[model samples]
Target chain A: MTPLPRWADVVLLPLLNVVLAFLVGGLIVLAVGQNPLQAVGIMLYGAFGYGSGFGYTLYYTTDFIFAGLAVSLAYHAGLFNIGPEGQAYVGGLGVILLGLALNGAHWAIVFPLMIICGGAFGALWAFVPGYLQAKRGSHVVITTILFNFIATSMMGFLISRVLKPVGVNSDESAPLEAITRVPQLRTFIELFKNSPVNLTFFLAIIALFFIYWLIWRTKFGYAVRALGQNPVAANYAGISNQKMIMIVMAMSGVLAAMVAVNNVGGVQGRLILNFVNGAGFVGIAVAFMGRGHPVGVGLSALLFGILYQGGQELAFQMPGITREMIVTIQALVILFTGAMGDMLRAPLARLLARSSSPTGAK
Target chain B: MESYLVDITLILDSTVRLAVPLILACLAGLYSERAGIVDIGLEGKLLAGAFAAASMSAVTGSAWLGLLAGIGAALMFSGIHGLASINFKGNQTISGVALNFLAAGLTTFLGQSWFKRGGYTPQLSGDQRFNPITLPFAEQLREVPILGQIYFELISGHNIITYFAFIAVPVTAWVLFRTRFGLRLRAVGENPKAIDTAGISVTRLRYQALIITAVLVGIGGAYLSIAQSAGFNNNMSAGRGYIALAALIFAKWRPGPALLVCLMFGFLDAVQFRIQGQVFPIIGEVPVQAIQALPYILTVILLAGFIGRAVAPKASGIPYTKER
Candidate 1:
């Protein structure tokens, strides 16, 4: 078997896996007595058929980009930062606190403040587990998983007990002043008319370039990649694995924290419980499907964005294909792209080898 | 003093009840990890088990059938994990995570489709659910003070699943320490090459470990839905599987210590339940969230300093290949 070309490995493989996952999803739909083609049609229409639908898809895409980048950044450092849910949750608190404190401040001032504070909060939340992994010998995966629950309970407490307005629902904070809210995309762009997509989408694109530069261009990036590839060899080359782990994890947390900024400041305009939802977990799959590269992450994030919006449409159009069923489909995608990724790799490699070989010369 | 005694009993009772599921999950992880397989998918298996148990009980009106069905479903998931990690030589963590998503998605989808109550099964009634069992002479023992209170409150009046959970701990400890299979399991975790040299199939050992783990996790999930509550709710495991992971770590991968650690976590949960809304003048009403976060906080603290370096099985999480 021959090795796949870089393009095939990067672009074509994930696309094929996605197709396979969709086929299996179609089978599931059939088992449930629904036409797979009709469902797909509805989903496509729901995700991209209209302007507002496209805007909403892009809005979710913004979230997945932030989260996928977070996971990808950590993956480069040979770490699985599963605590993004916690980090994003804590980051929401930071954004909310800043928004509340600077309630009457200009949008320009508040936005930057939110980014700094939110990033710091998220980084700080992750830093403890990172420090433990680096110095205390605790596995990052275990600590991060535990932190997710802690973060949830902490957010629940804060939203209900401290930030909640009296005589109102205990699960959400009082709305921030309109001055702090980012204008919706529809306000500035005719294409995204009447949708929640906002300026954060532009920020996500900027982040993509920034991460690409950080990971591929710099000496520190080289050191991180080296350590991830071979820690013993990297250590022999005088790289401090401890320092790199800490910095990379903190960076990962910062990216994850941005999701809160997008959701709370841009979309919700208020802090709500579980606003991060399962975006953090979904990010793991995004990074996996994307192959932990900036461009790959961006493309996969868009794919997932479409899936989210389209899944909702499919659920609405077909009662049998419930929202949870969409989750099942998403899970199948993750399974094929992640856990069972190698299922088609060997066969495809052989096929490519056979096609490219000089048969007549041989 | 009398009220304090009653409170202690109440807390102990809740602690025992809560610890049952946690103990089962910890033991499940213990077996798998000991066999050199990292089972982060315990949460998934537990949830699948809970759903199966609840749905089957709701339909068949037999808790035992629900228990068997739960075990079967959990085993199916565990088999997938084994096939992926063992046969495909895939990343164990990724496989585990995928299993979790699959369980979460599948259970809800099936439950919603079948029962139509937003992914919750129909609530089981008396004969279909595991009810608390009163001990022999419990009514007569009420007047016997401390021993009677211990017997009636702490020891007795829990479902049969609780008894199985407690018994399983000792059995697990014995199996891990006393038997030849136990030695092989320990050897497999520490150094699979050594076992391979001894002409044993590492894959089979790992698969057996996973099967045992799944059955235990299944029972844990069944205990949650059928004994703790009458029906299964979506994502009903609610991170207890992770708490069990913390317990496994806190116990330093030993069975006896794992059980004790699970109980300790349960006690923390019971305390959190009792003190959720209480106000204190000096501290200004400890928020329920702080109490809920206590076990995780303590686990982190223990992982960092309190416990001296908890070492996992040496080969755990590394896919063992015959050639490599």
Candidate 2:
């Protein structure tokens, strides 16, 4: 296949999206009278260059990976899966309960079991919308949005009412015992003279590889992709469209659960309100930004994690810029990359189609 | 028995107040989606309008002027949404979600930075408040047994906006069915290609409809801020926008049904508020969370085939494209 033309194969689309986002982001900075170059530099350094900052970035990215994966799985089955936020919380509850309720079992056995429980619970939550979409033809967007509020409020109810921290008046769960805990890597960064990245970072990469194999190297993958492209055609091709959608949604649920299990169990180790903090929504941005590719999703998640960490740091250092600026930047990035990018995608797709047609046919 | 009667009256009055904003916002949503645009940003637009109205009213000492400012700002925001989604033919849902996120961040930032408040704008006094109109025979009516409280409380004594919200229902019905512009608007929504062939501009009609919805939603937001609480706070609109969308779906996008749907949801919310201390006295302190979650849970149930399956406008949430 005489090496696919570089521009048509790669360079243009993702590059164009990044450039467009930056330019729009730059205009926003200018509007606020901040030097675009310096702000960008500061954001980068604040996220990665500092000792503590990069640690938080890695920690944050771990959650993002789950979110990105969740969105991508749903996207593969032609479902938006907007309920990741809800699924993540349910997963968070599952892991937290497991951690608290279980005694001092062996680490290997207990940890894996909790993770599976978290994923299964999360997946079950996601399946409701998927089932509705496939069977009743309900719009996934409205259904999922509805579930998010229910999940958040229900979790809050349990945490504050039934699962309140022992010997405390406040609305919080008791922190997990050390035997059931994820060992802190923050100290290991100094002790081992290594980066602040945790064991979860390695686990995330492994998960991504597994996702890639599941998506590309499996028969299920073919069914999902086919369903996404055209469910009617996929049905004609002897694939069960409804089954494929349910499976994909289940996969998304597990991915969303990983965020909750890993974040709550491996990092925070307690149930908290708003703790998911729009990561699910950001995952939608990442899924579209990455064009539903694993590697692309990983990179976008890292970039977002960096920005998030930096945004927190900037709030502390500047005193002038508020913590909400981070959210503004996030919104603007999503706007340019998601909606505005579509405005440009059609033209680029046309150009690629034209250039690659006859030559590519050969 | 008298106490029970007072409780019923209070609950009735609360339902009307609760339903007015939902009715208005749902009507706004009906117009936009009917014209082939999805509006997930109603919550955000309402937030921006609420904040603007509250701040403007507090500063200028004129509630009416604040309402005008709120409408103007919302129209401009909706115009941005239309330009991005309709003209540029971008993804409508993404644009709407982005607008919400932007509003969430921007308003909070400004509220804390400028106002030096706890993400809340200052409260306004009676001078900037709207008065409700009570029934004329209320003195004689409350003593008139069965229909007494209903006539005095539920049927009457609602603010001007509540009356307007109910009237707007028929006006929307008439505009949608009788008027030439409304027919063309529906045509653009249902089948833009047909409208394009019939010498109508799809882009223009959509933008016009969105802007009109924006104005109505702006009034709804003003009612939320000044009329609901007589002030504003960051994120005060909460999830009212989503609830309205739920009502719109539950209503199946028609005004007559939309009004009833809003009232039903409003009733649910009002009952939840009233019962937190009675039925769930043990969970009495949980009112804030319970009430907050009520609308969303109802929405999910409705979507899951409780009330009915709601089919949206056929061409909704799709960006219209034309050949160059």
Please give the DockQ score of every candidate, comma-separated: 0.65, 0.56
Per-residue lDDT of model 1, residues A168-213, tens digit only: 9557998987778866788878988878898888989999999899
lDDT, candidate 1, at B273: 82
lDDT of each: 0.88, 0.79
The TM-score leader among the candidates is: 1
Worst ten in a row by lDDT for model 2 chain B? B279-288
A287 Cα displacement, candidate 2 (Å): 2.0
- On lDDT, the candidate that comes out on top is 1
Off by over 4 Å in 2: A1-11, A29-38, A191-197, A345-362, B126-158, B277-294
> What are the chain B TM-scores of all models?
0.98, 0.91
Residue A284 of model 1 has an lDDT of 86
Model 2 clashes, total count: 0
**Cα lDDT of model 2 by residue, A188-305, tens digit:** 5663223335566667788889889988999988888899899899999999887777778877988988877666766666777667888887787677777678998898888888
